[model samples]
Target: MRILLVLFLLAVGCAGRDDGEGVSTQRERDSVVGASNLPGASGVRGALRAADSANARHGRLDSAGP
Candidate 1:
């Protein structure tokens, strides 16, 4: 949740910039990278990815061979 909040703030801040300059894609990308690098977020993301991989490998229910 906190990581999401930080990302949101970064996006909003960039959007509200004045000086007639439009949105900066670099900053947006940086924000995403920064968010992913946040402490605990990486672990959570890694665990989720691992879970998905494991599920894909063993998702089918079948009877064991005798």
Candidate 2:
């Protein structure tokens, strides 16, 4: 039937729209990479170091007696 044909076409068309923008942004990432390579990487390394410190602090707190 024509109704079934239209419904099938609609379903197929809708299914292809979720392909996640269909392009790799990595190829365009060269410009920003050098910026992150600068002195101390502008707190990026510090941020990761802070994560470990925070986890350690939380572990200490969790183990302390009330």
Candidate 3:
């Protein structure tokens, strides 16, 4: 009875603690560029432009292939 109560309390405490592995440092997070970093329609346009530029560059290389 008391042993079961103690076990339950231990489990509850452990579940709420962060083991530190899930946390990201400021520098680590800053190095990532995700969609959340961009704001509205302009962000979408910027992403499309970058994709198009990459595709054009790839096409140029492929055209020169053996």
> Using lDDT as the measure, which candidate wins?
3
Where model 1 places Cα greater than 4 Å from the true spot, the runs are: 1-38, 60-66
- Sorted by TM-score (best first), the order is 3, 2, 1
lDDT tens per residue, model 1, 1-66: 999999999999889547566656754644565468577766666666686787776754333334
As for candidate 3, its clashing pairs are none
- lDDT value, candidate 2, whole model: 0.67
Residue 29's lDDT in candidate 3 = 47
What's the lDDT for residue 55 in model 3? 95
State the number of backbone clashes in model 3.
0
Off by over 4 Å in 2: 1-42
Better of 1 and 3 by TM-score: 3
The superposed Cα distance between candidate 2 and the true structure at residue 35, in angstroms, equals: 13
lDDT of each: 0.66, 0.67, 0.70
RMSD for each of the candidates:
14.6, 9.4, 9.4
> Pick by TM-score: which candidate is best?
3
In candidate 2, what are the lDDT values of residues 1-66, reduced to their tens digit? 999999999999888556577654642343244357676555655565576799999999999969
Q: Write the number of the candidate with greater TM-score, choosing between 1 and 2.
A: 2
